[model samples]
Target: MGQARSQAEPVRDDSLLEGTIWTPLGSASFPAEQPLRQGHPPRTEALPERTATRTSRRCLAAALEAEKQWARAALGAIGDAVLTIDLRGTVTYMNRVAETLTGWSQREAIGAPLSRVFPLVDGKTHRTVITPGRRAIEENRTAGFALDCVLVRQDGSKLAIEDSAAPIHDREGRVTGAVIVFHDATRSQVTLERMAYLAQHDPLTGLPNRALLTERLSRALGLAQRHRHLVALLYLDLDAFKPINDAFGHAVGDSLLQAVASRVQECMRVIDTVCRQGGDEFVILLAEIRRPEDATRVAAKLLAVLGRPYCIHGHQLLVTLSIGISLYPDDADDADALMHNADTAMYHAKRNGRNGHHCFTAEMNTRPLQRRRTEPGLHHTLQPSQLVLDF
Candidate 1:
């Protein structure tokens, strides 16, 4: 060699670096450069290592792009709502479900403050609630909304929702943003409430059941004792329910019971509670009363309203109630004793005469024992075939 020529320098390819690419932090776009045309392929044997390295990088980029696309598709196809926010507390992404739930489109929500896009409030107090994403970012961990959290949408409508938020971190373990996932919880919340209502109420009449009545009675007694007020309990039994149930079957009997519950509720104040203690028996609670006469007036009004004819299933049915009254601290101090005394008084009203009311008395307690010992059985006195019901 006349003068040893320096090894030919390899030509660098700028097309690969110029292509647009996406990353979690950001993305960019650029016009694609056309490939160079040559008469023949260049010999790469001289620089096989450089050629292989470039080819590997191109394949890796293509794989990464495919994975990114797959992830985007998966997120968009999910049922639950998904949202992402940047480090500046601004919205960056919203899935289709998120758009539908928050009533905000991704185009309009992007770059907007997270609070403006996803507002929340307490379901009970209606107070503003912090977005879970904000909490996750501040705390650098996962967070979730409390039970009964409500989401206020863009159109002003509110939705009951459940959600969780987690901080999104980069490869270097630095928190770059936050992501939230949520779903509508309205149906589940309604189901829970309906179950609770059914547990404490009569399914037929939709009135408080025996358990609820007992609970309220105990509460009323506690408050009465503290406030020095009198609480009254009225025990009532249908005067002619058995014969009607036997004659018309349970359909008409159930309807009559519903009507009775409705009328009893109408006669009561908001403070009073009316409960169905199964079958044709009901109990009314007067949370507070000034005198025994107040209880008597309520009983009288109930008798008059209930005595009216009820048109059920084309049958004009007439019914009456035998109501017995008892007072807390006067008849008995405890709920059970008060209930027992009222029940005894109800039996007294039934015996002396049906369709009337009576106040509990200490002497009346002995009457039931005496009558049961001296008189014949009630079934022996009246037969099912001989029983005549008025309708």
Candidate 2:
């Protein structure tokens, strides 16, 4: 369909629409000057049929132009980019957002190949990803880019985009063209990543937190169950951490913790997971363990590396860890129960001695519970708003 412009007439231009029929893609001339037309001749008995035909043609063109304007306005008002292409994959129209995103205006983008104007590639490998409009044409249905797709703009810069295209069909249900819609996804992706990090990580140490630890353990257990492998869960508590933080300042303590996390990572395999369970406590998961002794070996290595003196801002200080060990299947039924048993063992190690490791025993659970229950209460302390006795 073509857009109409105003003109005076017996419309010298034989075309039904005297004004420019604006379709670079459609069958019409763009904006131009029009020759003036004089008044029509008086009606005759024989001329009525011819007059009626011209009137019908004029009405049709006007209606078509109105439809074209409505479509353009609707597409332009959209916030997301919109691209339209003809059957040959040539770009037919692009709205304002599309122009900004592809860095090509409607005037320039028209008649250009969809790939030339809107190229996408693999975000990591930079390999050419299939152009969606062309793909839709080939598939004869809606098509979209894969995850981590990057759009290559006219200026040669890249942006993450989520876009899809569907073939436009003719009156007979034949695919005639395609319309694609897309939006920039960079900010949304970044926000999602940031939220994920904050939800599962310790802010001070940048290590996975208790919530993430449980998740990792669950996955590890699932894998171990399938592969019939041993999974080791270690809960570590830094020895003398409270006094070190109180005497050396919290800043130094945080620095030491960061250093400790770094060292711990270095000591483990890439398949392993280490998460901080808040404040001087960390959990490590070794998912590919072959035997029970594999955990003890790792515990020994961790003690050696973490026990090394840390020089934080010129203050030389030594630290050690008390680790609790629990094995999958051998210790507990589920990840949470496994970690709980490991945590109980950690406290057992702490009570018996500092800077050592303890394996979970059935009795360890009862001992810690008994200790907590027996600890003296502060019920004798005076409470506010209580009745006073005149002794």
Candidate 3:
């Protein structure tokens, strides 16, 4: 009966394993005793496929690494500073410029708080600046930093900086992090200020130039007309300046002009403006003076002060100015007329002597005020009436 029952049971084939194996063509399986055929590729044939897969994987990894290195190089080589932070406000990455500007290394700054990496303050208000990156991350938008912003570095040094922050996003358009780009704008700001200063001031003597003088004169005239106050304009020319310039080099001449400008500035009040018209000519605007005699006093004081000898570059030089005074309502009303009359009076002062002041009068204009230049010196000779022209 046991033999009969064993004969009734079907024998299971262990060699015919029900398992899948990778092949060169695809996945397949067969009995262990069966030879590999066109329908079923052998295990040995799968080696080429596996090797090719490995090679593809290695190539992909190498390309990704190269891309990462290229990105780092580009970031490091940029002129502006770059910093990145996660949504939690933790620093994630920093470029070379960012490291130098913030005084924090990437190794030291990574995983640190954003505030620790980038500390800022207002340049004018001296208050703590709010981080725009945090706002950008939270609001999911780009934000600009404050104007005239100053950055206080990790080592306690400070620099002027301008920066902006933008929210970074993933492929799905979800906000992932924030990027902050900044740069050192101190040099640029200083350059702009220097340019503006040069526009209105004489580069040689550091005095107000003709453009600035005219602007101030116009404003002063307006205020004087409104308040019924007197405004005085004193036109001055350095006597024999050309002869001295020709005798000495331009270096000595420049030094002499600077010295004269300094002396003239010292003789004026805080409310006055001393201007350099051009060359050795200067104009003084005495705004809101009490009386005409007030200008006379200033002129006398300037003559006394500037007439003194100046020691420059081991040479003692003496210079004097021929000043002409013009009043707002007394000489002429407008700025141009007042300036012209003052200039005419300055010529008269030159005609009288080298070191004196004259007040403008209508009679001074009646004569041929235009003078012809004589050779050998800056001596002037009165010309015909036709020679008179607008200054």
Candidate 4:
């Protein structure tokens, strides 16, 4: 009977072990070896399955953390300021550049309306700039625009920026938000304005140079032709300038020339143009002249201005100009031809005597011998008929 009981006890324990909860280390009996009372079998509790579920949840949490890290790194790398706004123009996302440009951190910027964070104005008119986020939400279309604007920083300083905005869309092909990109353009814009100024002005005299002078002359010529009026061209050559340059050196000569240019400019009307045609020569364009006497009066004024002595570098330099006057249509048709005839008359003034003025005439072109005789210090023994003609 004892042997039979031992054998039955082993079978009963084996059955209990199979039905009870088991760990890797050991197995636990559910009833703790108590005498069998009712007809209920031992209950089994799940342990490994619960541990597997907890591990899976931990792995999923780690993956999400890694994705967030990557997204932050990418947002910080962009050079331009980037801002994302919702349909109502409320800020949703802001990159590092945006924070720096707007003088607000991401914590301060997000959830705030765009107008409250960064006010915008039109590039030209300084009025309120169009809101792309509101438009995108209202119209449900892809809207975009670019403009130059001033952004007020947190410290109350202003920054010049070029801003571009585009509508942000969702997976359903519906516009839901807006993304704005902006960058600094102050230095570039200033450089462009400086270049434009240099292109139109002379660096030396701070005056409009040949290119600007030609443009003005073209307009003046058109007006003169329309009104059937005469325009005068005055070609001026500095008399004995080479001697002054040789005696006082180039520095003093340049100073004297600048002084002479200033004096000549002061003598002219605002409607006239005075331009330096290289070294020791200048060209003047006088518009709306009614008679030849008007050109003579301007020529006399130029001579008086240039005839004065200039004190440069403690040296008194006496300089004078020989001016030649040529009337439009009487001398030639266009600017080039008129300039040429004026130059020819200047040579006549130089030959007659430096520091004088002469008007161009057709007779001067015909009588070559008389032109030669008019030169300064050219002695010719006059015959009886020539003496009578001169008287």
Best by lDDT: 1
Candidate 2 residues 1-391, lDDT tens each?
A: 1122233324454465445333223213323364233453222343355456667988999999999999999999988899989988899999999999888888999999988999989999999998888889888999987888888999999989996899999889999999999989987788899999999998988888888877888898999999999999999988766666766678988998999999999999989989988888889999889889999999999999898777776677777788999999999979879988998888787777668999998987666443331113222332211211222
lDDT of each: 0.85, 0.81, 0.84, 0.74
What is the overall TM-score of model 2 with all chains considered together? 0.53
The order of the candidates by TM-score, greatest first, is 3, 1, 4, 2
lDDT of 1 by residue, 251-359 (tens): 9899999999999999999999999988899999999998999999999999999998887787777887899999998999999999999988888888887799999
TM-score of each: 0.59, 0.53, 0.69, 0.56
Model 3 C-alpha lDDT per residue in residues 1-391, reported as the tens digit of each score: 4565467446344233224343454334545586455653334664576566666866998999999899889999998899999988899999999999999999999999998889889999889998899889888889999998888999898899986999999889999999999999886778899999999999999999999999999999999999999999999998777666766668988998999999889888898999998888899999888899998898898898988877777666677779999999888999999999999888888888769999998998789855633233343442222222323
In model 1, residue pairs whose N, Cα or C atoms come closer than 3 Å (at least 3 residues apart or on different chains), thus clashing, are none
Compared with the true structure, model 4 gives a TM-score of 0.56
Candidate 4 lDDT tens digits, 1-391: 4455457554532334434554543335434676444753322343565455556766887998998788668877978788889878899988998898889899999999888677766667777766655665677654554466677676767777775677888778777788787767786688899898788766665566778778887888889899999999898888766656766678977887788779888988988888887777888889889998999998998787777666678765666788888998777778877877887788888877679999887766665533231333322332222211111
Runs of candidate 2 exceeding 4 Å displacement: 1-183, 369-391
lDDT of 4: 0.74
The runs of at least 3 residues in candidate 1 whose Cα sits more than 4 Å from the true structure, single-residue gaps closed, are 1-80, 84-97, 105-131, 134-140, 145-152, 155-162, 168-177, 183-203, 219-230, 242-251, 289-293, 367-391
How many clashing pairs in candidate 3? 0
| Alpha-carbon shift of residue 326 in model 1 (angstroms) | 2.2
